[model samples]
Structures are given as C-alpha cells and as structure tokens.
Target: KKRYKAQPIVLAIPRGGVVVGYQVAKELGCPLDIIVPRKIGAPHDPEYAIGAVAQDGSMVLDQKVVKSLGISSSYLEEAKKREIEEIERRMKMYRKNLSEPQIVGKTAIIVDDGIATGSTIKAAILSVKKKNPALLVVAVPVGAPDSIAAIKTLIYDIVVLATSYSFAAGGQFSQNLVQTSDQEVIGLLQKASGPQ
Candidate 1:
C-alpha cells in the first residue's frame, strides 16, 4: 500500500488469517491486530459456513443459503446466540486487557488465509467499517474465484494472489495445510505485541 507508505494499518482475521496477516504486516512494517469472527454453520453441516459473528455482537447472515436450506427463523436466531456466546468467550480469552485498534482515518488492510464463502471477510470488513477507516484494503494469498470476485465489491480494494476460477476447497491450493491450534494463535499474537 505505498499509496499510504508513510503509515498503514494491517488487521488480520485471526486463526487462519493470523498466519497470512503476519507476513503482510511484517512486509508493510505495521503492527498486526486480529479480528476474530466465528462462522455460524448450517445445521448438521458444521464445516459449511453460513454466516459469522463479530466480538461486539455484530452478526451477518447468509440469506440466500438460509432460504435455500429452508432454515427457520428460530433456527437462525439460535445459531446466532450460540455464535455470539463463542464471540464473547473468544473476546474474553484473546482480547481481554488489550485495547482495540483505532482505524479511523487510517488506511487499513484486512488479511486472511483465503476466502471460502466470503462470509467471514464480510463480517470483518463490516466490523472494521464501523471504526471509520480512511480506506480498507483486503489481502489474501489464495481464494476461490467466486469468493474472490464477490469480495471486491464489498471493500475499497482487494489483493488476491490466486483467483484460479477452477473452484476447489481453500486447502487444495496449499501443499501442507493442517488444522491450527488455539495455542498457536495465542503465541502469534503475543509475539506481535511485546510483553502484552
């Protein structure tokens, strides 16, 4: 983001995004901060993402998917409650005692490992927007073609390394992708900020 090279801000969607964000922030010489949002999965399809919730009780639903799946309002509401609880739990664990970043009037870049449904990134962008950033740029190493395309309309700018329209799982692009542990995320955050 040389356009704002004198100063820039990097926000990484945590868990998966942390790794990608680490590299981006390191390259940009900006401090890294995580925006953790839990995906509210479809009933009986936990791996599939239908929506997501931010730490501050912000939630976004996938109306098209919900309608296609015929999920009831109650079911959606219940899912939101569960995800909000998770948001709270994670906020307390990962964010306690840590002051949140100030994005107002600053160029911000949100990073993630990849965009699958774009729900999580949407949530992250919406949450960041509330902070009134001067500009918001999204960066991801790899993402599905549709997902990458869909996300560009939501943010001011987006940088995606691979938009191979072939369509496959996010991990398919990686040589050795493994489930990341919570311990690893905590370690990365601690390392980013000295002694906090």
Candidate 2:
C-alpha cells in the first residue's frame, strides 16, 4: 500500500504472525505491533483449541465444542487465567507501553502466518471490532478452507495469497513447515519497524 501512501498500522498475531506480519509492515512502511492470543486447548487434546485469549484479557470460546466435549467452565477459566498472564508478560516484553494502537479511526489490519481452524483468528477479529476501527482487514498467506469459510462473515475484508477449496491443513502447502523462535520474531519485528 506504500504506492498508494496508505499509512497503516500493522497488528500481528504472535508466535506465527510475527514472521508473516513483518513482511507486510515492511512493505507498507508502517509501524509494527503484536497481538498475542493463546489457544485454550481442551483436556487430553491440548493441540485442539476450544477457545482463545487476547492480549487485553478478552477471550472467546467454541461453546458448541466445549459442550460437546463436556469441558467445564472452570476448566476454561483456568486456561484463560494462564493465557492472560502470558499476554501481560508478552506485552511487557514486546511493546512495554505502546498505548495499544488506536484503531477507532484508522485502517487496522490483522495478520497471521496461517489459519487451520480459524478460531483464534475469529477471536482476534472480534476483539478488534470492539475498538471500532475505520476498516478491518484479515490478511493471511494461507488457511484451511473450512476455517476460512467459517470466518467469511467476521471481517470487512480478506486478503489471501493462496487459496485451496480442499485444504487439509495450513502447513500441507508449505515446504518449510518448521517452528520459528522468539528471538527470530523479535528481530523481524525490529526490522519491520524501520521505515526502509
């Protein structure tokens, strides 16, 4: 958007979006910030997310799945507590006092590395909507078809580079599907913050 002089602020979902968002911010010549959300996984299926917690202590859960799995409200509460603690800690480590960018009258774009179930992304969209931004865009390089379908109504705009109607998972399309480190994330964020 630099060609059009779009002075936008980028909010990246951490752990994965840090890397993906760094590229977008660098290209847009905008300031980069982070929005860390933790997936509250159900018991015995810790990788399966039942809900998500945002950095500001706001949370959203899949009530249907929660009920179907017989997961207790107290169980989710405990998970949310731990997730919020991490959010607070990450905010201090990431931005200190950056004033949580004002999205009410600005173009606020949310970025993520990939989407599988899209639960966390949906929660992120919902969390940002509360701030009443002038525009809300969900940008991702990759995502599962079903997850993307589930969230089609949650955002004002969606930008995706690659799409497959029969996607099995987010990583199946990637060749270098490996985990990224926190130090790498910090470095990328720092690089993107520069107006190069």
Candidate 3:
C-alpha cells in the first residue's frame, strides 16, 4: 500500500503460481490473472535455461551463458519461436475467451511458487514492464539466493518467504508437489475472475 496506495492486480506465473497468486488476490481484493513466459534452455542440457520469451515476444537472455556456450543466433531464434508458441498455447488454455486484465498505471504483483534459475520470472518482468505499470513487484514462496540476486535489479520489490544458497527445484520445498494441470489453471482463473 505504501507504493500503490490502491489495490494491486496480481499476475501469477502459471502451472504452480496460480495456487499462490489466487490467495494473494483474494486477500487483497484485487483481480488475478496470468502471464505466460517460456524458458529457452540450452541445446544439450534442456534443464539449463539460457533465456526466456514472453507471450508478446519480449525476452531476457543470459548473455554470459550464451557467449560461453557459443550459442548461435539460429538456435536462439528457433528456441524463441518455439517458446513463444508454447506461451501462446498456455495463455489460450488458461485465459480462454477472457481478455487479460488491464494493468496500465496499476501496481503489478508477479507471483510464483518459487524461483530457480529465474529465467522465466525475468521474462515475465520484462513483458509486464512493457505494459507500463506503476510498480512491479515479485512475490514468491522461496527462491535460490543467487537467482533472487540476479533478478533484484529488474523489479521494483520482491517478497520471498524463504531463500537458500543450497536450493534445488521448487518441488523440494513443497510437501505435496503435484503437477498442476491446465484444467486446474483454467478453473483457478475462472474462480478468481468471478461472474462476468
């Protein structure tokens, strides 16, 4: 409230973030929505993210990683194309016929269950920044310390419940780590939006 003075809209990173962001939006009495950003991983090591791309084609690349690995422009372009397609698919599945909530001049709180490499969130932040929000904040349950530090310069504020140097994947911090389905995401988005 110190920053926004008004209720802020929450943009939940889908799959897992919907769960966390739903409660936040409910508690804040604000609208809840999503932003889909797909990670562009390394060639051989798919788990190692080199960058991420948003639904609008906005992107964030780890130049150091790309340069060290000698990642080619062709590969990056291909990966970005594929990731943008995925983001579009997910956005369609989640939002369906509903249009995205208006965030211009409003505080945007981007929430996720946790952060790992931070590639996805970074992409989400850059995408949201393009919309010209009043303030951009990242709220998560936990995150890797290095990942948190890496993204600190990009966002207005961060609210992380926990952080650790030895952090692994987000599932490790959860008691019941179920793979959230697209249907679940759709249901949550509908519930958050209420009757039209």
The TM-score values for the models, in the order shown, are: 0.89, 0.87, 0.94
| Candidate number with greatest lDDT | 3
RMSDs, each prediction?
A: 2.3, 2.5, 1.6
Residue-level lDDT tens digits of model 3 in 1-196 = 5556645999999889999999888888889999988889999997898988998888889999999999999999999999898888788889988897888889999999899889889999989999999889999999999999988999888999999876766866885778778899899999988863
Candidate achieving higher TM-score, 2 or 3: 3
Q: How many backbone clashes does candidate 1 have?
A: 0
Of 1 and 2, the candidate ahead on lDDT is 1
36 in model 2: Cα distance from truth in Å? 0.7
Which ranges in model 3 have alpha carbons more than 4 Å from their true place?
1-3
True-vs-predicted CA distance for residue 144, candidate 3, Å? 1.1
What's the TM for model 3? 0.94
What is the Cα-based lDDT of residue 6 in candidate 3? 46
Candidate that beats the other on TM-score, 1 or 2, i.e. the better one: 1
lDDT by residue (tens digit), candidate 2, 1-196: 7333334778898867988888888778777788788888998898888989886667878889999999987888888898889888876777643556677766778899888777778778877888887777888998777777777777767888877765544666665867777777777766665557
**Against the true structure, candidate 3 has what lDDT?**
0.89
**Candidate closest to the true structure, highest TM-score:** 3
